[model samples]
Target: MKQVLGSCLCNRVTYACENNFSQFHLCHCTQCQKATGSAYAANLFTDVDNIKWLTGEALIMRFNVAGRSISNAFCGECGSAVPYKSLSGKALVVPAGSLDCEPNIQPQSQIFYTERAPWFDSVTVCKKFDSMPK
Candidate 1:
């Protein structure tokens, strides 16, 4: 199995995981939106044991929504999302943007579509740019 490296925005935390992912999901749940501070969250799932922390494990912080299965793990220094074990402890959920390279699988489905943010309608409908418009 191939391994892909991942790190936080400030590089405070780093890890490696198998490039083989079981599932990739674009989650539109309200809880996910709030946790990610975005319209949706793109996540990759793999076996719980597939990841190895390379450094800064102590700088990681986690938050679990009260009375919900939702959870998030991030770097304390830069607040960048990283990988975290599933609440059930069965899988590792990787924030797609954390990876140094690309995952082998594309997003398979959108979960909780009904809960998607109203302003998230058709991202393609907006102007496309290689960089931020001045």
Candidate 2:
């Protein structure tokens, strides 16, 4: 099994996960944009068991958004968003950009397309969903 390691800017918080990701997505929701301080968020979803925390468990913090518990585990010193676990308590969604190794994955879909900022370009390429695409 392949493994990938990642850490915050200060290196106080570290994490590792299975290199094989089950799903990848770019979220354009306002919550994601604010949380990441970016136009969009690139997330790689994998089983919770595949993720391992190497350091700084005490510094991790969490917040609930729209009833979903979004854990914003980060380095308290650097304030960098590290890894986040779902409130469902089933999976870990790591920011692809935070990985130390380049993950062989690309955004398969864009979610919350309707909520995307007006300045953002419409994702005409890959599948786009207005909401969660349920």
Candidate 3:
């Protein structure tokens, strides 16, 4: 695998990671949902050593949710989630949306499925639109 580039929605923060992810998980945990403001969080997990910040390092802010190991990193300018090491310091968690290139692999698992939002299960059946509906 080669290095993949990533940036924030505002393009103020950029990073590169060696494509060495060991797992790709779509976390359906409530915390993940809240952090993403969506049904689930698509995260790619890898060793922290594989990540390298390319620019706007000082614009990144991180917070640890109370009473949970879950932590979130985002660009202060645009509030787009960015990669951060897990609270345990063992792995880096990259929000799949932040990647500028497709990951070398696909999501391997849906974790905490039972805790997923009620509407999440119906998403696949929802209407598809290339752009916002008129």
Candidate 4:
């Protein structure tokens, strides 16, 4: 199994993942854009059971963005985004930018394409979605 390491900006909260990843996606929904304050968010989906928190459980904080049922986790000290789990409690989504080592994965698709900001750069040829696909 491959292992990947990640930590918050303060180095307080750390985590590790095994088995590389099967899917990578970039989300551009308004909620994601507002939460990340960026053009889009790069996320890697992996089994929740495969992740292990290595440190600073006490410094981790969670926020539920308005109107979005999903909650986002981050470091309380340095405010660095951490991995987030789905409300269904089945999987984990780790931000590629937060990884301590390169994730060695590229987004396979872009989601909420229609909601993407007008000024956001257009890159990648992956499939695009107007919203979470039904």
For model 4, residues 51-134, the per-residue Cα lDDT tens digits are 888999788888887667656788999988898787778888888888987776777999898999887765465578999988
In model 1, which range of ten residues has the least summed lDDT?
Answer: 120-129
lDDT of 1 by residue, 19-122 (tens): 99999999999989988899999999999999999999999999998898999999999998999999999999999999999999999999999999998887
Candidate 1 wrongly placed segments (more than 4 Å): none
TM-score of 4: 0.83
Top-scoring candidate (TM-score):
1
lDDT of 2 by residue, 1-134 (tens): 78889988888888888798888998888888888888788888888777788988688776677664445555678877777777787888888878999776777999888988776775455587788977
Off by over 4 Å in 2: 66-71, 122-134
lDDT string, candidate 3, 21-127, tens digits: 88999999999999999999999999888888989999999989999889999999999999998999999999999999889889999999999999887889999
lDDT for model 2, on a 0 to 1 scale?
Answer: 0.80
Model 3's lDDT to the true fold? 0.93
Against the reference, the lDDT scores of all candidates come to 0.95, 0.80, 0.93, 0.82
TM-score of each: 0.97, 0.82, 0.96, 0.83
TM-score of 2: 0.82
RMSD of 4: 8.2
- Higher-ranked by TM-score: 3 or 4: 3
Choose 1 or 3, whichever is better by TM-score.
1
Pick the lDDT winner.
Answer: 1
Residue 124 lDDT in model 1?
A: 67
Sort by TM-score, best first: what order?
Answer: 1, 3, 4, 2
